[model samples]
Target: MSRKRKETEVFSLSFLDCICCGFGAVLLLFVLTASRKADQMDDLQSKIMAVIGDMEYEISLKDKEIERKKATLAVETRLAKDSGARLDETKKRRTELEDMLKLLLQQLAAIEGELGKLIDEKENMPTQEEKVPIPIPNPDRRQYLTGFDILGNQVLFLVEASGGMTADTLVDAAEWADKPEKERREAPKWKRVKKALKWMIANLKEGSNYKIIFFNKELVPLEVGFGRDWFDPMDPDLTVEVLNAIDDITPEGGANLEKAFAIVNELPIEPDRLVLICDGLPTLSDSYAGGGNQVMYDDRVAMLRAAQNALKLNLPVNTIMYPLMPDPGSAVHYWRLANSSDGSMISPSEGWPDI
Candidate 1:
């Protein structure tokens, strides 16, 4: 028993010391490893946080760009709408101008129609005044009288200068052998014819054109040459010269009526009116008369031919017939000629040119 007690306790001190030392070394190693792991985890967490911050900054920049684009689009839309409104206004103004143009054209047409109507009315109105006498002053104190509307632009006076004009009456033979040449020239009938011609010259309208054709065997101009046709607004001195020329003419030739009408036809411009002064029918025509004293049937035929020429001319032949004592036939034939030509025939009475 003593020997077993001296052997050792169940828990030996050296074994316990070894166990404690091992346990302390294991605890110290665990603490150092844990520290190193903590440091590595901190580094990984910092890198993740930096990456997330950069992504958030990029998103913010994208959002600002979208807002700027939206504002630009809105401004462009407003400008487009304003332009469309202006275009519509311009179209409306153009339409209004076109309408105004149409209205102006209608007004002009109406005014033209009114002017045409007024002109027609003026042309259609009838005048009451019968005679419009020329207002020229008569220095000879002679009467102013005319049956015709002698207001033509061109007028012709045809005076017959024949041996018969020297007679006391148109039909009676003149006593030319018994009387002196001066006395024969101053015969009352011939004097009256000259006076009438002078009166006509004096009474011519101011600014009127005229011509004198003294017809006997041929047509002869009073003052002007054969080439000259008319005298426009004859001067007083020229008129006096013409009258003197007529006075100097001696009545001797046979009255050739055919030549007178033929001359009228030959004129380049036809006279508007013809004033024919004669005492008898035509004595000489295309040929000589068969007998002297009276107009024969052949002479009448010749006169008829002359009248036909006048008719074809269609110019008004105003006749101033000095009464023939024996040949009432002459008056009747002249009346027929005047009627055919739509002319006027006036036989002077006691008050001669006044009638």
Candidate 2:
């Protein structure tokens, strides 16, 4: 029995040793796998660090680019500001030019008046056998002045008081009003305007009633007076005052043409003379796109608003545009106004004559 027991014990011990050897082999294989895995993880970590470093460098480059753009933007902004200042200066000069023009207009009016008086006297004189009647120069030979001789008709001068007026027309009016009478007559303004005014004022006979009005977006009196003496066509003071007051004229803050038409409609006067002197078209009135340009409601709306208003007034409108621009309607509006009112013009059927 002892010998059998000893043999079984030896077998069991051999079995245990075999299992220990297998366990050792498995542990060795696990160590090899772990070492390979650790090597792969180290490589991946190196690759990730390289990529991260590259990303940081790329980010730094982008930051430098952003700084360059900022510097360029600053330079551009400064240049634009300088350019804007220059533009403002140019606009100021333009206004000065406009003032000079108005002075010229007033001077022309004075000259025309003197010429008209001389011409009338010359025409009335009897032709003698020896004496020849000097032919009077006709400033407006295209159409003879008419219906102006009818007295008691109120003269409502619808002067344009748009922003454009501030530039030239009105400033000259100030200079003309304050200037000497002789200078007013001798200047090119009166030299051109004298003849026209004289012919128009001729209608103001002994006891005629009249009133002079200046308007843009509102109605203002240059000089308000009535009666025959009031219509004295020989009012040098009046001429000067009108020319000066005209300098104060300005365009509408925003064109509400309805206001202008309403003013005329509510005047409660019959047989009136409405003169409209403007450069551009109507803007800011009630119409498509809000009367003028939505982006910029610059000039008056050149559309048919003026024409429609003229139709509503049922009266002739004398539109004198100063150096009208942008073609077609810019110049042609005058003709439309004249035709609508059953009136005719002499020269500058499109725009105004510089002289």
Candidate 3:
């Protein structure tokens, strides 16, 4: 009944409970360690994935760079090919030019040999017709000008095919202007001018090229057909064609010397020398002046303009002045033109054939 004190026992429930609690704490510690290890592994895996993504991005940039380099290489190769083609073309052209030069040299040698033979034949036994060696007014090895001493490889004839060419006086010029084409064609002065032209053509060298331009109010070429500007007098058929063409032409318009010289300015290739066979100063400039004691002031002004234009050609202007009776001033102006341009003035005696 005392039950005052519970006796201390060696094995008690409290002690057992303490042992069990210690065991539970050990199990909890083991689980926490396993969880911590798993968490560390996950973090390492995330870092590795990020590194792989960066490496993939670098590889993509490298591929793009390689593509760009390939494109640049392709362009360079194309340019190189184009340059090679141009070089090949240049070489071919050079070869062709060399061949042409060789051919030209051979031809020149042959021509020289023929010329020597002609000289020998001419010296040894002159023919009856060759006895009076055509008096070349200004004999030169390079050219055969109609009236002047100047020589040239190429020659142009600027003939005044105007109504004034048919007569010696303005009254007659007006009268002839009213005449029919058939009658005007047979004028005495016109015939003489034509004869002189024939003589010049006959005396030209066999291979010489010439062009005849007739200017009145406008310019008229000897041959208007395509590819037929210069004439070869050596060809008998061509000579007849030119002669007939001249015969067909009739003097009817007022003389326009300005237009005549302007034709020279417009030539595709300038001649070495020019022979202007004009009667007087310009009567018709860009416009016409009625025949009534022709104004000399305007004529001189127009002639000055023509002379200045002619000077631009930088070649000798061998003037063959026709006697336009009352105008000695014309002769003076022509002389000044010749002197300024380093040319000669030849006034044929009386008529055309006299020269």
By lDDT, the best candidate is: 3
| lDDT per residue (tens digit) for residues 1-355 in model 3 | 6668868898799989999999999999999998999999999999999999999999999999999999999999999999999889667656645554464476568769999999998789855654556665544422223445423457788888888889787787778878889999998778877767765665566667788998887788889345587887666556656776888888777667767776687788778878788787777665344345655656655655654674467777777777666767778777877777767777777655542
TM-score winner, 2 or 3: 3
Off by over 4 Å in 1: 1-146, 168-172, 177-181, 224-229, 287-298, 310-312
Model 1 Cα lDDT, one tens digit per residue, 167-241: 646345455525665776676677778877765665567777788888877777766544554776446445544
User: What TM-scores do the predictions have?
Assistant: 0.52, 0.40, 0.55
Candidate 1 displacement at residue 316 in angstroms: 0.2
Worst 10 residues of 2 by lDDT: 141-150
Candidate 2: tens digits of C-alpha lDDT, residues 1-355: 3555444465587898999999999999999999999999999999999999999999999999999999999999999999999889667656644654565677679779989999999899899677686675753322325422223345554444434332235455455545554444454433333233333443355544444454444555555233222234445444334444434433333234444555666555654555554544554444334433352322343333543563455555555544323333445555665665654433323222333
Model 1, backbone clash pairs (residues 3+ apart or across chains), number? 0
Q: Would you list the C-alpha lDDT of every candidate in the order shown?
A: 0.69, 0.51, 0.74
Worst 10 residues of 3 by lDDT: 141-150
